[model samples]
Target chain A: MTWIMAALLVVVVFAGIGITKWMNSTATENANENWRDIAQAEIANSMVMLEEPDLSEPQADYYEGRIAIAEHRLANDIPSFEYASMQQQVIDTHMMMSLVTLLAVIMAGGIVASEFSQGTIKMLLTRPVKRWKILTSKYITVLLFAVVLTVILLISTALAGLLFFGISDGTLLVWNGSEVSETSFWLEALKLAALKFSSVWMISTFAFMLSTVFRSSSLAIGLSIFLMFTGIQAVFLLQNYEIVKYYLFTHTDLTQFFTGNFMISDITIQMSIVVLAVYFLVFMAISYWTFGRRDITA
Target chain B: MAEQAIVQIKNLSKTIGKKKIIKNLSLDLHKGEITGFLGPNGAGKTTTIRMMVGLMRPTEGEVWIDGQSVQADFEGSIQKVGVIVENPEMYKYMSGYKNLLHFSRMHKGISKERIDEVVKQVGMQNRINEKVASYSLGMRQRLGLAQALLHDPKFLILDEPTNGLDPAGIREFRIYLQKIAKENGVAIFVSSHLLSEIELLCDRIAIIQNGELIDIKNVNDLQKSRYYIQAEPLELAGEVLTGIGFPAVLHDKGYLIDSGAEHIPGAINLLVGAGVRIFAVQPYRETLESQFLEMTGGGEIAQTHTK
Candidate 1:
């Protein structure tokens, strides 16, 4: 299992690096094409460039701004178009969080189920240790694995991004609903990774709890990952009912609370935290009761 | 029964979803002894061992190892116990040595010397560095013993330890278990559905049938040794044997009598005095298979025994 996970991590990081390089080249070409199209449109309309240009197409307007900025930098004799602001690095590297979480969820689902499937739980349970300690050791191992994956994700993506897009000083942008705010790039990225990890950890805990209840790794991983992908959509479809806010999937993505994206209007971040805490305790309780008290006939 | 008790299972009952697996079973294991558990299929031998080792919880009652209740303090109670509930499972991805090292982390002060000692004790020194996936069944069993003995446990529980072993491997395993029990003062509780294996391995045999303990007897006392002393004038020979307190019954060509091998000469002399010419003297001792059949009441294992 350890070797498999290591092999998977290596494959994923190299794949991420390969894709990042391809994506960077394609993105630059696409941006240049969009810039040329804008220039042709302006020439056709015979309009003067304005400090604040009016455009009906939101995408076109955004591209026009980038083109203008590029022209200004070029006029200033800047040689590189691949110079990405720190904020762009954050954006370019953000997909890694999703990949790391997927890995974390799979690892979590395998924790107890693998032991049961392989019949290794007998050896573990027979040891001179309480079931709770054994369980806690597995849970802590999950968290550590998640942390390790996240760190690999962070480092690998950072290197990939730096290799593809030259780093430049820029503000980390935060949308305040009324205006954008500037923040330290590293701190903001850290906050985003931490928030993303909160969701991963919660989903992992859910999978870990499922692992305790189920004997098949495939069943647990399949169900947990299924719920992971479709849970929010299912919750959203039923969210009109006030009681749906208390559902587990509604609060699993603790990032929603930090991002101020409320699944329910009245479900505050603190309330979500409390709900998740209650769920965490409940997951642990079920694991304790089932794993500790139940017979291990297998 | 009053000897130093290493494990005491009291009224152990296990029911899973309304079907009772073990019913009101109680047994004791003493220090410095190898006790074999025997039963027919689904007779709860493994269930009882599971309950004893805290792998399965008893419906009512508790297992006390070294005076600490497994229910109340699992760690403290099981600390003195080493168990191989079934085929010993391990992380196949790890070397046997690394596997031992990993399990040693759970218990404090399980030294490097202890690990090496157990490795040598189980005779896995050469193969300890190889991944467990590469080991044979006997080697895996030995590695399992190495892991079980790493802590120098006072009590050892093995549920069907010889399931896949060859004859020579089984002999070696028995020798190691006997050595552990005698030299380390570790009480060993081994269980098997195979009666013959139990016969050769244990000092005392515990027979359980249908979730109940049927008998616990010393190997020497499994049954009274019975012999057939055939001779001419069978009726007179039977009478002469009975008159002399041999309690012989008339049989094919002569008589059947219950006596150890040592008493054959006296019986033969008494029959000759009665002018009965002895033809043949053959010994018959009750086997574990027959006893198991009688205890299980001619159930699943009867086919094997009768054949």
Candidate 2:
């Protein structure tokens, strides 16, 4: 089971890297020609939106800003950063961290629950080891698996980036609401990927807690995966309420602060970190309490 | 009889949701003794064993193993205890050797040599490398035994240790357990429903009925000598044996007399000289099954026994 999950992860990550590289390679082959065409098409598309009669003031400003960026790109001959480049791929790799979260969840959800299901928990608990120590060992192992898989994802992405597209020179442009400015793609990728890993760590910890509390891996994995999607959707649904500030999914994506896509715009990075830390503590406490106190009937 | 008790279960009570599963169960297990724990189904035998091994906590009282409390000092108390609770469930995904190695790591100072020695002791060296998934039930039991013995535990608690073993395997297991209990002076407590097996394996038997320890007796005490005599005119034979100070009781078309072999010969001579015709004479004994059924009130469930 251990080796199979890791092998599947490598295959999946490599496949994702291969597919993304293929999709992005065609656009960057003729960089200048492709940029000009893309900018013209983008300008035309934004121009139609700018012509809308009922467009709100901010909406109209957003479309006008997009048109301005495209026009400036064409005028300055600043082609959009090539997605096939190593820096861009490293920056974009975090987008696929949901896969890492999934694999980590599988590992965390089974680490302790499988012992109960297979009836080996009796053998495990009857030893000279205390229940708390056993639970701690399992929790540490789950954390290690998550960390290892995340590292694998990062390494595989870099390998794929290096293989398909060697180093490429391009300027990363970001519009700070009024004007486009230059940014370091490598720094941006590192920040975004690190932020994305916070979500993976939080979700996998949640899955681990469920695994120990319920002593059923299927239920833990299923419930965790289900909540991972629905919980994020719920943040948008509850955005109008005051409770959204404290809701777990609202803060799970720490990248929201940097990406200008906050579900609850009032929440700061510090607030999100605090909320996530609280949830993490509650999950860990429940896991330990239930595991240490549970009767080993299995 | 003068030996100190190595495992002391004192006033151990388990109450699960208003049901007293084990009611003030107190017993002492000494080294170099094989103590058989016999109980009907759901009579709290497993519950008591689990509490002793720290799998379940006792609601009241505690189990002390080797002068340490199992509830308070689990690691210290259970350090020298080997437990095989309910078929010795192991990680079937790994090899049998890996399973032993996995358990060996949980202890303080078990070496690779010790694991190999235990594997060889259980006669599993040939197939120790094969995954436990491929092993038969008997082989699994042996591997289970190997893991239990890995740490050279001073106290061994086995719950149905011979559940899947064949007759020969059971005999081999019994001999092995007896050897450890005697040679190594390991305090062994075994819970089993097999009456004849317990009779052969245990030096002392503790019988539990309806969440209570109803009887604890030495195997020798249950093996009193008596003789069954089949004679014509059973009434005359009974009178003749009773008049000769045998205290004969009529049972199954015969008179049962509790006496030594010398007295049995004389009693038979007097009975034959009288008008009673002696047809057969044989030794009689009460099986453990009958004694267990009698003590447990026909082996009904505890709920009925309570009312």
Candidate 3:
């Protein structure tokens, strides 16, 4: 079962790259011609946003930062990274992380629950080991599975990028408040992938909690995957409320701070990390508590 | 009988959803003894077994094995115990050998040779490499037994341990259980519906009904001295037995007298002197089946009576 899930992840990665190639080939011959003009237009838009009197402090900072990066790009003659560029592929590889999260949820949901379904939990729990220790071992196995899948995603994306897009001269520019500077695309890509994995970790932990609490893998996997798709949409729905600042989905994507995509303008990355930490704790607490207290009637 | 008990369950009770599944049950198992746990359906038999093995926590009291409390020190208590609850569910995707290996790793100091020895002991070496899904029920039972014996547990708890084995396989299993109980001095607690099997395998039997232990007796006590006599003129034989101050009860076409072998010859002489034609005489013992049914009220389901 694990081999099948891993194989499916690799297939999905290659299929994603294949689709990108097919789409890029159908575009006009001058597909790369107007990136410079697009950067200039983005700079003009951010400049206009900066002139609004009612713009919040973080909102104003966001536009100013965008304008600075765009102006720096226009001055340095640096174009926005195209979809087919090797550098962008490295960054876009994390976009396939949802699939990784799905695979991970499937595994975490079944690790403990499968024992009950197969009536093997009686055999397992009757061992000399403590119940908490067994649960801890299962949780570690789930985390290791997620880590291996992430590695597969990273290595596959790198290979696929080299094969299809080849090496391209692309400069990754980041604004450090006062100026824009060049950064390694590999470092940037790693940062995004790591941030994206936080979402995977949180969702898989939630699935693990459900699996332990309910002792049903289907319910755990189904509910977790459903929330994975709609959780962000809920952030959009709840954005106007003050409570949205503490909502889980709002903080799941830590990359929003670096990408300048703030759903709530006042919230800081530090606050998001704290919120995520709290959620992680709650999920783990529920998982361990229920697992230790459950009666193995199955 | 004077030896210390290896397994002691004291005032154990379990209440699941207000049903009071097990109510203040207590039992003691000694080394070199196989105690059969017999109960009708839904008589808290499985629940009691689960509690003993620490699969379910007791609402009150405790189970101790080899001087360790199962509730307080799970590892210390269960270290010397082997359990097979019901059908001995294994990972069907893995081979029988791997299943044993998987369980062997959970215990300390269980080497690869120990696993091989157990496989051979259970006579499963030929099919141990096959996946559990491909094995028949009898084969799975063998594998289950192999895994349970892998750790060489001092106290073995088996629930329906001989469910799917053929007669030959069952005899082999019964002999193996008896051997371990006697040779290794391991205490064995077996819960089974097979009364005749229990008669042949167990040293003592504990019977439960409606969440309570109704009786605990030695097999020997249930098989007290009695003899059946078949003769012509049963009335004359009964009178002669009465004349000799012996109680004889009519049974089938004969009379059954509770007597020893020494009394039987003297009684036979007296009957012959009275001209009572004796056809046959044999030792008589009641089957465990009739005794179990009699004790458990015909072995009816216990729950429906409560409602």
For residues A87-140, could you state the per-residue lDDT of candidate 3 as single tens digits? 788887777889889999999999888999999999988889999999999999
Candidate 2 displacement at residue B233 in angstroms: 7.3
lDDT of 1 at A43: 39
Q: What DockQ class does candidate 2 belong to? A: medium
lDDT of 3 by residue, B1-307 (tens): 9999999999989998888888889999999999999988889889999998888889998999999999999999898999999998999999998998898888999999999999999998888888999999999888888878888899999999988999999999999999999999999999988878999999999999888988999999888899999987988999999889889999998899988888999999999999999999999999988888788888373342232
Q: What's the distance in Å from true for residue B237, model 3?
A: 8.1
Candidate 2 per-residue lDDT over residues A61-127, each given as its tens digit:
5567667778888889887766567777777877878987888898889989999999999999988
Model 3 chain A TM-score equals: 0.91
Candidate 3 is graded, for docking, as: medium
For candidate 3, give the lDDT of residue B269.
94
User: Of 2 and 3, which scores higher on TM-score?
Assistant: 3
Q: Model 1: per-residue lDDT, tens digit, A80-177? A: 22324334555444446666667887888898988888888899888888888888999999899988887766665566556655576433334333
Model 1 CAPRI quality: medium
Backbone clash count for every predicted candidate, in the order shown: 0, 0, 0
- Computed on alpha carbons, the lDDT of every model, listed in order, comes to 0.76, 0.85, 0.88
Compute the TM-score of each model's chain A versus the native chain A and list the values: 0.73, 0.78, 0.91
Q: Top lDDT: which candidate number?
A: 3
